[model samples]
Target: MGWLALDEGYEISLVEGKVAVRRPEGRQLKALPKALRDHPEVDRLRRLAEWLERHEAACAAQVDTWMVSSLPVPTELLARVWPDGAWQAALRDLAVVPDDDPDEVGFLRDATPGGELKVVNLDGETVRLSPRTVTLPHPVLLPDLDDVREFAAELDITQRVEQIHRPTWAKPADLEPAATEVRDYAGGVFPTRFGLAARATGLGYRVSGGYATCKVRDSGRAVEAAVWIGEPYWDDETATGALNWHDEDGRAVRLGEVGPVAWSEGMRMAAALYAGRRIEEGGDEA
Candidate 1:
C-alpha cells in the first residue's frame, strides 16, 4: 500500500518521484506514463511479474508446511533449496535440535551439503555441527525458552511452529477423570491441539508458540493452565492436549483434583479444538 502495486504480472511502484514499471524480479524497468501504456517492454515485464508472484506464493505455502510439521529435516536437502531467497528466509533462524539429543537445542545458522552445518549452540557459541537430522523445534523446547517465545510472537510465527514441547500434567498417576476425547500428538506441544488456540487467544489467553495460557479461579483460588498443541503427524484437522493446572501456591494439581470451574474450562478448551473436525466414515479421519 505504501508504494508497490501488483496488477497482472506487472509491478507498478513509486521509485523516487516517478512511476516505475517492472517485473517483480526488479529487473527490466521503464518509466510509466499514459503514452507508454502500450510499450512492448511493459508487456514483457507484466508476464514476468505474474510468474514471479506465483512462485513466491508457492514457496511461502510450502515453507508453512515445513514449519507446522517440525519434521526432522536433512541439512543436505536444505542446502539444495537454500539458493531460493524465499525458501532460505523461511528456514533461517529457527531453533533446531539434533537427531541425537532432543535436549540439546541450537539455532540454525547455515547449512552446507558436504561440509559441517553451522549453528549457534545453546551456549551462544558459533559451532559447526553434523547432526544426522536437523529439526525445527517448537519454541517451548528452545534454550531461553521464554525469550525464544517472545521473538516468535514478535514475528507472529507461533501457530506455524506447533511442535514445541507440550506440558504434561506433571503427574499422570494423579489425574482423575482421564481424558477420553483427547488426541495425543507425540510431537505436539499442546495437550489438546492447535485449533483451540484462536479461541483461547480471543478470550484473552496468551497464545504462545507452544501453549495457550491463562489463569483461572477455582474455589476462590487462582490456577494457571497451559494447554499444549500436538505435533502434525498425529494432528490433521483438529488438535488436542492435557490440562496442565497449577494450584494457588503455584504447584501442579494432581490428576482428578481440580474443582468444578477448572475442570469445565479444561474440557471446554479441548472441545473448541475438536469442534469442526469431520470424523471418518470408518472411524479414521480422511
Candidate 2:
C-alpha cells in the first residue's frame, strides 16, 4: 500500500502487516516515530491489519471445513471470491475433483471471471476445467493420495489450509465391533489439566465437558470425536485419556460404525494432544 502523508512531513504505511514510518526524504525508519506514535491514522491502520488477519483466518477455516467434509463447492462461488487475496490464498493449490467426474483430479491454479477453472493435472499439464461443482476431498478420501502428494511436491505446492498433507489415521479392519474408544493416544501426561486443555483449544479443538472435541460431517451424518482431558477444576497433574466418538443424538458410536472422516479426525485430535505432552529426560515422552 502507498504511504499516506501525515502532519509533520512524515509518511506512514503498513509494512509487513505493521505500521511503518518513513522520513520525507524516503528513508524508512526501524520504528514508528515518537511524534506520530498516537496518530489516528496509525491506529486505523493497525485496526485494518487486525481485520485483515481475521479475514484471512476465517477464509482458511471455511476452506478447511469444505475440504474436511468433502462438500461440493460451486465454481461460481469460487470465481466470485477468487479476487480476494485471503480467499485466493485459502483456495489455491487445493486438489479439486469435479463432482460429476471424480477421476478428473487436479490442483487448482486459477479461477476465471467466467467461472472456468484452470488447474494443473497429474500429467504435468495446465488444463482448463469447467465443472459446475468441485470437491476438495479430504486426504483420507483421496484414492490416489500418494500420487497426489508426489505431484504436489513436484509442483512446489503449499496450501494455506491443510488438505493433501494433513495427517490421517485409518480405522483397522479387525477392530472389535463393540469397542467404543481408542486408547492409542492415552496416558500423555501434562503438568496441569489447564495446560492440556489449553493445548487442545490452541490446536483449534473445542473444550467442553472436560473433553477436547472435534466435530466432523461424514457421509451426511454429524459425528463428534472427543478425547478426555480431565475435569476443568483438576489443577494437579493430568493425562490425556481415550478418544471416543458419538453420533448426533449423543449416543456412543462403536469403533466399526465411525466413518472414515470422523475416525481420521478423531485420531488426529488425539495425536495432536498427545504430541504436546510434557517430555521427560532422555527425550522420552512423559
Candidate 3:
C-alpha cells in the first residue's frame, strides 16, 4: 500500500485493489474501487477521481439531481403530483405520472436487455395485457395494479433521492456524551445547560434521575418535557415530566418533554459567562 497527501484536508491511501480516505483525524472514511483508485499512475488517478466527484455534486445541485439517471428521480416530484392534504386520500388509487423524457426512457430501455417490450397508447394508457391493463408512459414507469404496488415503489425511490438534500449539519466537536454533562449539572440544584436552552428557546427544564428534563414550544402548543434520566435508574413513565406551559393568551398547557438539553448549548452558555467583561485573550467556545 502507498499513500499520497492531497490538498484540502485529505490523505489518500492506495492499496492493491482499494483506495481509502485517510481523514485528517487519522481515520479511514471510505474505500474506493481499484479502477478509480489503484491505477499504475495512482497519484494522477486520485486527483482525477476527487475532482470528478466534486464536479458531479456541484452539477447535481444546479441540474435537478433526480432525472439524472446516474442519480434517480426525486421523490419530491411525487409530492407535487400528490401534495399533502385530505385530497391525497383520494389518490390512494392513483399513480405517479412521469414527464416524457425521451432520453431517460430510452436509456432504461437500452440498459435492460431482453426485458419485456410493450407499446403505450397515446391516451397515456397501456393497450397491452389480457385484461387491458392501463399505464402512464412517463420515465417513472408505474405498473397499473389494483394493489398500487408499482406506485409504492416509485414513491419510495422518489423520497429516498430527495433525502440527499436534507441538511447534515456537523455537530460541534466537543459534543460530550449527555450522561457525563448531565451528571455534573445534576450535582448542582439547577442543571446549567437545561436553564440556558430553555431560556433561549423559551422553554422550561429541571434535573432528576441524572438528566435534565425540558419542554419547548412545538406547533404553537406545549407538551411534556423529556430528560434522559439514566436508563438503568429509570422506569418507563418516571423520567418524563409533564411540562407546564402557557399559550400566547396566557392559558396553561402541556408541551412534550425533550431529553437533557443538548450539551453544546450548555457549553456555549458556560463559555459566554467565562468570557464576560472581555478579560483575556484567545479562548474559543468549547
Candidate 4:
C-alpha cells in the first residue's frame, strides 16, 4: 500500500501487517511516533490488519473442512476464488483428484477463468484438467501417500492447508468391536485443567463440558469425537482421558461403527492434545 500523508510532514503506511510511520524524507521509523499513536489512520490500519488475519484463517479452515470430508468442489467455484490472495494461499499446492478419474493425483497450481485447472502431475508435467468437480482427498484416503509426499518434496511444494503432509493414523483391524473409547492418548498430565483446556482450544477443538471435542462428517453421518480434558472450572492438576466417538443423537458409537474419517480425525485430536502435555525435568511427559 502507498504511504498516506499526515500532518507536519509525516507519512504512514501498513508494513508487514502493522502500521508503520516514516519521516518526510522517506526514512522508515522503528516505531510510530507518540504524537500520532492515536491517529485515526493508525486505528483504521490496525483494524484492517485484524480483519485480514481473520479472513485468512477462515479461508484456511474452510479449505481444511473440504479436504477432511473429501467434498467435491466445483471447478468454477475454485476459479472464482483463485484470484483472491487469501483463497489462493489456502488452496495452492493441495493434492486434487478429479471425480471422473480418482486414480490420477495432481498438485493444484492454477485455476483458469474458464473453469480449467492446471496441475502438476506425478510425471512432473503441468496438465490441464477441466473436470466439473474435483475432490481434495484426505491424506488417509490418498493412494500411495508416500509417493505423493516424495513428489511434493521434489517439487518444493508447500501447502498452507496441511494436505499431503498431514499426520494420519489408520484404524487398527484388531480392535474390540464393543469398545467405545480408546485409551492410547490417555493420562497426559497438565499442571491445571485450564492449561489442558487452553491447549485444546488453541488446537481448534471445542472445549465442551469436560471434553475437548471435534465434530466431523463421515460416510454421510455426523460424528463427534471427544477427549475428556476435565471440568471447565477445575483448577487442580489434570490428565487427559479416553477418547470416544458419539453419533448425532449423542449415543456412544462403538469402535467398529466409527467410520474411517471419524476414527482418523478422533485419533488426530487425541494425539494433538497429548503432545502438549507438561514435561518433567527428566524429559518425560508429566
In model 2, where do residues sit more than 4 Å from their true spots? none
lDDT of 1 by residue, 14-45 (tens): 34434476667766465565645775655555
Against the true structure, whose TM-score is highest? 2
Off by over 4 Å in 3: 1-40, 65-150, 153-160, 163-286
TM-scores for all candidates: the values are: 0.45, 0.97, 0.20, 0.95
- Is candidate 1 or 3 superior in lDDT? 1
lDDT of 2 by residue, 22-130 (tens): 9989999998878888889999999999998999999999999998888889999999999999999999999999877788889999999999999998898999988
Task: Decide which is better by lDDT, 1 or 4.
Answer: 4
Writing each residue's lDDT as its tens digit, candidate 4 over 1-286 gives 8999997578988887788899989899997788887888888999998998999999999999999888899999999999998999999999999987887789999999999999999999999999999999899887788998999999999999998999898899999999999999999999999999999999999998999999888877889999999878999999999999999899999999998888999999999999988888888653
Q: Which stretches of candidate 1 lie over 4 Å from their true place?
A: 1-31, 113-115, 140-144, 150-286
Worst 10 residues of 4 by lDDT: 277-286
| CA RMSD per model (angstroms) | 15.0, 1.3, 19.3, 1.6
Predicted candidate 3 versus true structure: per-residue lDDT over 1-286, tens digit per residue: 4566665455666443345666577877665434445444456666666765565444433232222112233333333433332222322222222333322121111101222222233233442221111222222222233224343443442222222222122224454433222222221112344343333233223444443343323322333323332333333322222222234464533212211222222332333322221222473323
Higher-scoring candidate on TM-score, 1 or 3: 1
